[model samples]
Target: MNRKRSRGKNPWRCSHRYPLRRRRRATPGRSRGDPAVDPEDPEQDPDDGNAPPSDDDEDDDEAGPVVTTTHRRFDYPPPVPRMPRETLEMLHYDQFWITYVGTRYRHPALPDDWDMTVEISIPDEFGSRQNIHVRHAPTRRNSHEAAISDAAREALTTLCHAHREDMAITSRRYYPCRSVERLDAWIANPEAEQNPRLESTIEYLATLNTDYNAALDELDMVRYENRKLRAWVAHGVEPAEEEPVEDPADAPRRKKARYNDPEARTYIRHHED
Candidate 1:
């Protein structure tokens, strides 16, 4: 017997006649979790800056940059005060003393190539006087003058080292030596035979150096005031009134002398027969 079909509604619907919607597949380079895009979408462009990020880009954003922090400490030394150019130039050369003992002995057969020794006095880089001893094995062309010249040259080279600025010589004094014997004797007994002229020069240079450093400190104070004034103007505030400077005489005084009388000869020279 043939079964009769229901006329009100079909019990089983054909899948081809009413198909359910299926999810779209991702393209080859598309990442998971990214919204599926329609190839036919007019806004979608593979080469556009707005293109979806790949798997690597997403992973990088999830993992933030790896930073390395280091802590270090450094210690710096205080700055050295620079000497003015004029000062260096004026102090570059100094007086030297050379004594040929053989000349006083009336030795006519003294060889020109005899050993030579000289005393060199010049201002050091710090503007302090320094006395140096120089000895040279004389050649056939070397004389007393040549020996003195060589010593002076070496002393001058030391004074002008690392100098590239300008400074003026406020004052300089040159004293003539009357007698070497007297000088040597004075060296032996400074209390009895003091060189007043040289002592005065040393005192003057010490005073000058002290004055220069004090002037620098004053300049720093002035600059600090200027900076404060500028900051006050920027902030639209009235600056505080400065106190009157005290008289220099009223300031506390301390005798800070850097001068120590240097010996004429640091060590005695011994001659061998």
Candidate 2:
């Protein structure tokens, strides 16, 4: 026998009416928690400066920089060395002593040649420096002597300007040299001795130092005497105070002068004082 279908309402009424289609995802085939994008909304580039930074970008900024250095030990090359140093000249002018030292060194840029550098050392014993390394100047040519002279002039000029700016000469009873021409003339002359004023000042300083040392020695002797006196007093060894002279009337009478009368009589002589 053949079964007939129900006619009131079919149980599979809309099952096969339309073909099934897979809905396309915003990030094609990705069904993550990110909301569907609106096609009508303007596109935003994350690299744009006006756009707000993402949480991941902020976290990356907060993290410290990653170090990519190697841990292996490496033997580095030694530093370039300076050749033998020679004293170019020494002179005194305006209470200042200038010492120029010539130095030879191989520059990395000119490896085949040795270059000369002049160092100007001014002994400003009374100033802010003991032995001041004033300037280190390199020569354009191969003339060390001329270079030294030029360095000296330039160094003096610089020092003069510095003094003008801040009075950098902090030594007592001192001043900067303002005249380089006169100094050069003096240097050129063979018979030119040290500055007379500088000599006199130095002589006076030496005398003062000697006097100071003598005074200190005297003070030390005085202190030693004071300490010795204190120790003697503490030990009850100090000298006794001198007693005052007694009056003749209060003193006991002697027995010899009265008995000296011609017959050698034994009589006591009374003191009338």
Candidate 3:
């Protein structure tokens, strides 16, 4: 009877109203089935609408047009190998005597007299073709001759022993036929001076000779400059100004005056007819 119940109105109602209803969340198994309603789809985002498609999406979209990117790897070749060093061959030679001509003197420090003319062929480890010459003659007294003699004797003994050993070893070892033949020839014919090993040894020694000559040339140049500088300092004169003078006859002569008489030129008078 509150104002006559309408046919469509309900009799029961709440005094305070509840909040607005929220949309039902999508279930784990159920979907809205509408493509436009699917919020998980990337196309639904307005910012991503115009963005470029990812590789995965592009691959999924096309079936025939396969996009493949090829990467090329480069490899560098290894460096070249170096050649090995050659092994040295041993050699033997017969004993030969040599004469030396020089002075002999004795030092106060020496127990015995020293001789400079002692000639001995010492064996070299490098080869038998090489020879070393030693000369010892002290000009002053109280020289270290004893010590030098001891050292020289020890060196000579060692050299001789080593030479014998090397010869024995070489005899047991292999040697080039040509080289041996040349050695035999040299031993047989003393005057026919030709060495088979000479060519190779000379080639090797040429490099050393070139270096030695270069050093000598440099030393000579330095010595010449030093001498020139010393001479200049001693004389207290510049080298550039020391020019030779010409002879008196070759020098230019000055003009001479011509006189009619000897007494007339002694006095010069004013002109009077």
Candidate 4:
């Protein structure tokens, strides 16, 4: 049935307006039945307006205490090392005796110009063992004479060292307490000029110095000859020979002719003819 339209409004407009008003429920985020936020409520989050309240503490309790399985470590000491079986043992002796066992030259034919091997026997080893040392030119290539000098010098050095204490005692005996205020200062006094001990030491040292000087001179000659020979050998040069000595009897003698001689007279007559 057709109803009478309102006087001021259109019929279509009135009908659409009433239905829209009744169909529009609450606005999207807010509804009439939704719970209101209490300002004092502890469980509610002031910042989280959209999310619901949660029971975080109850959930953590339900998960219980965390259990972790760890790996066990085993520690043992390092293996002990064993000593080598092939190691040699050192020979130990309380005392050792040394004895001269003669010298051996490097070259038998040219012994004077060669090195010498001095062998010393170890008496503790029952003379079966010997220590051989090469005695040669100390500074440069010299002669066997220098080698002998070196051996003598070494022997004297050893002898002096061995008898050092004895020599000191002997010196003290010569310069007694009455000699000076102190034994060391005895040589500083003028009276010590006549000291027998000082004289003997001076004489001994002078003799050694003289011998050493002689050896040095000999060694110098040997060194010069050796160097010359080596240089000549390097250049492939033969050594020069000594000149032969002239004999007075081998010279041709001329006899002086006298005017009275027959040969001279015949020569003069031949020339005249």
| Residue 116 lDDT, candidate 3, scale 0-100 | 22
Clashes of 1: 8
Q: Evaluate residue 244 in candidate 2 and report its C-alpha lDDT on the 0 to 100 scale.
A: 45
Clashes of each: 8, 1, 0, 0
TM-score of each: 0.20, 0.20, 0.17, 0.28
Q: Which stretches of candidate 4 lie over 4 Å from their true place?
A: 1-111, 125-150, 166-204, 207-225, 228-273
The RMSD of every model to the true structure, in order and in angstroms, is: 39.1, 45.4, 50.1, 55.9
lDDT of each: 0.28, 0.28, 0.26, 0.27
- Expressed as tens digits, the lDDT of each residue in 24-73 for candidate 1 is 24447754222233223678653442222222332211111111111110
Q: Evaluate residue 158 in candidate 2 and report its C-alpha lDDT on the 0 to 100 scale.
A: 34
| Superposed model 2: Cα runs more than 4 Å off | 1-96, 105-129, 165-273
Residue clash pairs of candidate 2 = 126-171
Deviation of model 3 at 103, angstroms = 19
Tens-digit lDDT string for candidate 4 (1-273): 975444543322211111111212334774432223323478975443322112221121111111111110011011100000000001122222222111221211122233222222123356333332111122222343344344333332222233334433332222111111111101112234677786666555444444443454456556556644643544434323323424321111112233333321111001100
Q: Pick the winner on TM-score between candidates 1 and 3.
A: 1
